[model samples]
Target: MTAFHTDDPQPKPFRVADRLREAREAAGQQQKALAALLAWDPAKLSKTESGTRTAITEADVRAWADATGMSDEDRDETLEILAHFKVNEKSWRDRMRHGRRSVQLQYNELYRKSVRFRIFQTVWVPGILQTPGYARQVFTDLNELDPDTPRDVEADIRTRMARRDHLYDSNKSFEVILTEAVIRTLLVEPPTMLAQLVRLEDLLDLPNVRLGIIPQGRRVRTAPQSSFVMYDDLAIVEGFVIDNPYQGAQAERFAALMERFWADAVEGPEARQLLRQAITDLPK
Candidate 1:
């Protein structure tokens, strides 16, 4: 949600199109000539260069690099940029062609396989922590956003609620941090939010979970960027226009920075107290 993001279709600098344009120009090939060289339609190359193509595939990048005789170093660098920019311009809904239930099953597998999870949520409750009522509303709202996609909120809710099964495993851990605004957000109905808060209170007794709640009024230095889940070393970041995964140094950095939020967080009894207060303050 930083200033670098834009909803408009206009491509950003140093992205795929700019890099492709630079390489093609350096190789003395115009759009039509390059398209013929790569056996691609001229319009495909044009749309790619104009940033109108919704997706720039890996094959497209590699073919362009190979055709232009790009240096290995420059090709690698451009590939990295391609990787980052691909997901940078789209919402999470773009991936839901099959529907939310499909993704939920995929996540259920991930949750089952991973032994440790470190989560930082800035908005609604984390998926594993959501109750049936809360999850239903969440799926409904998101599904409504994409009318073209096949809608099945009940199936999505069932699949999502099933993900909670792994929570009881003593070998696995769920280290989660939530901002005060999570429970405060009226993304769902009053009763549903109230139920979610009550569920948070119960999670306090869970031996494997270490719940931390960052009070809204708490002073902090750098702002937390996005909601992210670290399934071991991998960081899956959720942003306004991004639903991307990071690994290696990038993922490590996300995990390290999460410590700051944990440091500012109030846990144990304090977290329970906040949840109860939110419940008490709820619309009755």
Candidate 2:
């Protein structure tokens, strides 16, 4: 068997890479042997199998399958791994090199194509529902150190506005829950917060988007966790942390967690009332 080592706290990627490595070993092939079969350098294979490099294409997976004499079923399984690899890659430098605008466009495409979006935000408003002012404040906070922060800020705002279209498009369904503290905390000045409150009021009118408010008092019971977004296919969970994106089984776990949040979540007019109270309590 191919011996592999991984230090990833999340089990999914390591498990996937281990499986592929095992398959190669079962076929009696070394990393260098497999690399030679696929006309790739041995280091590339080593990096991929070790989970150091994660952006494997379908072609690479197919080549690996061919090198190992894997059956069609095995090839299909490897293709799925390639899909997960694409979804979970978190190289921010690569994103910047390719231009974040294009990356945002691709994200928008994913949002638009998804039939359902499950999101839980523990801090500020979720991007899809944020008002432009709130979005600007958020982007500014996130990009303040960069010299091109202003341009990046504008691009991010536009990207977020584009993402908001999914809420009203009627073709997609959106289920979002926010902690009461998100409404309680003022991300910007009072007037901006007021306008953001108004925006939430407007978002409540969208038929496709279901908003749940976790009351401030409920915070103790639920235990605040880092925020995450689960796509409809449950293939990705984009964490608030820059380095740690989750996919495959890890994504599924978060999706299930969102379901639990939904079960205990308040909805209907009572939730609306709580949201209104939150706005009223904000400083004038």
Candidate 3:
């Protein structure tokens, strides 16, 4: 028996990965032998199995399905696992490669598949409603000091702009809450920040999108800093490091958090009025 370490505290994906590994072992193949069959480095197989690294290409999943002689039903189940794996892979790539520019696209795809989405943002605007220039400025500010700077800047901007299409699309329901500070923060120049504020106003009109702003002066009762999103179909909580696309408990906690925030959210004419006031206060 080969021993492996996993960082997952919940153990759902790790169990699924273990099942796939067991199937290979049942067929009397070693990790090296299986990697050779899939044309992947043996270490890649080990890292994936160990949950240290997760980036499964669709091709890799299909190969595993075929190699393991998975039934039609099982293959579909395996593909779901692959989808989760791929999402995590893309996330890690975005963080590490710094050139990868599709986090918003990936989030949108997940949103489309999700019946409900709950999001919280503390700094700057949420990606779904950010104007292109504002997004560029935000990404530029965040990444400028890094060596990867200019090359990654444009790609990140494009990716964020592309994600905005989901705001207008009616297929999925989105619930988003932003801290009042996000509105006041000047990630971009004055003109661009004004554009972003206007964009948020436009987004509030969308039937499918629910916008909430937590006043900077408002009382804070619960958790104070981190932001997260919860998808309905699957309970996944995405963070800066790991994407747990299948954690049921974490999903429930965030869903409850969303409800708490939404209940406390100021909406309708009053909300719009507050937004207007925030825009007026923007530095000229």
The parts of candidate 2 lying over 4 Å away from their true place are 1-91, 145-150, 219-221, 235-243
Error of 1 at 40 (Å): 25
| TM-score for each candidate, following the candidate numbering | 0.70, 0.63, 0.61
Clashing pairs in 1: none
Descending-lDDT candidate ranking:
1, 2, 3
Q: Candidates' lDDT values, in order?
A: 0.80, 0.70, 0.66
TM-score of 2: 0.63
Give the CA lDDT, 0 to 100, for residue 279 in model 1. Answer: 88
Clashes of each: 0, 0, 0
How accurate locally is residue 123 in candidate 2, as Cα lDDT from 0 to 100? 87
Top candidate by TM-score: 1
- Per-residue lDDT of 1-284 in model 1, one digit per residue for the tens? 11112322222323778888889999998888898999989998898887767578888889899999888888888888877665544544454656777667766777877888999999979999999999888777776655666888898998999888788899999999998899888888899888898888989999999999989886975486689998877677774323566778988999887888888899998999899989888888
Between 1 and 3, whose TM-score is larger? 1
At residue 57, give the lDDT of candidate 3.
53
Model 3 spans with C-alpha error above 4 angstroms: 1-98, 102-105, 145-150, 233-246
Using lDDT as the measure, the top candidate is: 1
Candidate 1 residue runs with Cα over 4 Å from true position? 1-95, 240-242
| Candidate 1 local Cα displacement, residue 126, angstroms | 0.2
